[model samples]
Target chain A: MTDVPSYLSPTGQEIVFLLLGVVAVGAALLVVTTRQLVHAALWLVVCLGALAGCYLVLTAEFVAWVQVLIYVGAVVVLLLFGIMLTRAPIGRAADLDSRNRPVAAVVATATAIVLVTVVIDGFRTAYAPLEPGGGSAREIGSSVFRTWVLPFEVLSVLLLAALVGAIVLSRTDIRGRR
Target chain B: MHVVYPAVVSALLFSIGVYGVLARRNTILVLMSVELMLNAVNLNLVVFDVWLRDRLHSGQVLTLFVIVIAAAEVGLGLAIILALYRNRATVDLDRLRALAEFPVPSPEDADDHLPENATEETAGQASRASAATGPTRPPGRDDTPEATP
Candidate 1:
């Protein structure tokens, strides 16, 4: 903390990160505030992709790729499928927002103010010099296999359970035992 | 890179998610907002991991775990939403109030409230009566092909 870099001179990496962060935040705002149902999902793709770029700028290379693959690739598609299957209106409808928008806006604004203040106060001088290869697949894989194998295996089991649960819930033929 | 950049971005994203979850009427939209919130947490994890440079890399590993869990959650949630749409014929969260408790009518006003309660009760009773007649059938079987056709 004593030898922290001053905020007056930001490195190239910080500049790139802030740019990507702006894109992500803007797209995320569009995702929530968009009136069209399908358009919201598309905006979400933009938001997630920008976040992936942010991760790359942060030097978490492996996490960035995974974020792109899992979130931008699979999750957005799943959400689109959900929107279509539910027969959501194709064009903008007026009632997408509920009556609680004003209250929600107030709460969200308060949350943002408090969180931003706390984080800025706590980490004002926490500068991390970016180092390449620290977040590569080789490093993360070795760390995961060596130190985090138990949780990895448990997560696989959880994924399998969720898969089975989804199938059971969606299928009409699978009746529970009374 | 200053840690506050990612931290502040994540905080704002989370607040947007909170707003979407509170304001959206559609169940699927609510799910999207939840994903935003989860992504915000993931960003926080990755940033902290990079900052600390831990030997175990717990932050990145946990971010991976959170991603996997988020995938599972979206799958299950969409299934539940599909089930809800199938049963209720609409996915509007505000209208899905079957389990909401309605105030019981006081005896003094029972006479005037008869019409309103009658309408509500008959809808409940009709559904109940149908269930009573089909004791051998499985409950919530409306999606069955034979039942549909």
Candidate 2:
């Protein structure tokens, strides 16, 4: 068996994360700017896919896979189906403009600045280099099954409720007494 | 390795998604924008979880829950859009202005707002234009009518 490295060096990992981050951000911008609904969906897939890559680079392999399986694969497909079903005009709709673009921009920019400041300040005092070999799937699995059991069970119930809610909403004949 | 990379990326993604949600008029495109935002959050969670090196893998668990929730959201959202389309015959947001009022209208009354001519010509033109630019096939032009409703 190949020996696992004691630790991952911060430099290489940082570079990889930066690159993925750039890709994710750029794709997200495209998702917003694109006028066509289908084009927007396709760009969304790219953005989400790059995010999954970022997760992998962060050593959270299971989360990365879940991102791919759920966001890129399932959510996007459902959005496409919704587009087709609604027959939303494929071209740009005339009402895209909001009267409050300037206000929204200011708010968003302020939020970004504040968040950045908070994050940088929070991490200023402590710096922990990436630890190797701790985020393996087996370790994650055991922890979930053992210590996090209650939350896991609660999540399952949440999923069930969501499923039932979806079915009820989609049913055509809601008033059976007709 | 620092979590900053993923954090920054997720933040940017979330910002763009916010712009899309605020700017786009089409309901479908709006839904896509929401997906972008969710993905941004997922990236952040996974990165931080990895950085912390906690045994619980809370980030992965959270990501899983987000996925399930997103799926259900899209399903229900689509159903609502479909019901609206059946009644109004158009999904243009500008035309849905009255939706804000919560004013109830009979389905037959809703038909008055529909474009008078649901012509194949305009739909064909739209589809052709979209085919050149958009990712999926256009809505009304499906030759396979017997397929899923």
**If scored against the real structure, what TM-score would every candidate get?**
0.89, 0.75
Candidate with maximal TM-score: 1
| Model 2 residue A86 distance off true place after TM-score fit, in angstroms | 1.1
Clashing pairs in 1: none
Reference-based lDDT, each prediction: 0.85, 0.66
Stretches of candidate 2 exceeding 4 Å from the true structure: A1-10, A91-99, A125-128, A176-178, B92-149
In the range B1-149, model 2's lDDT, one tens digit per residue, is 64454565666677777776666666776777787777777776766676666667787777767777787778777777775565445565545555422224457645654643443233334444555654443333232222223
RMSD of each: 4.5, 10.1
Which is the leading candidate under lDDT?
A: 1
lDDT of 2 by residue, A15-96 (tens): 7877877877888877777666777788788877878887777667766777788778888888888887776667765445
Lowest summed lDDT across 10 adjacent residues in model 1 chain A is found at: A1-10
- TM-score of candidate 1 against the unseen true structure: 0.89
Candidate 1 docks with a DockQ of 0.71
Worst 10 residues of 1 chain B by lDDT: B140-149
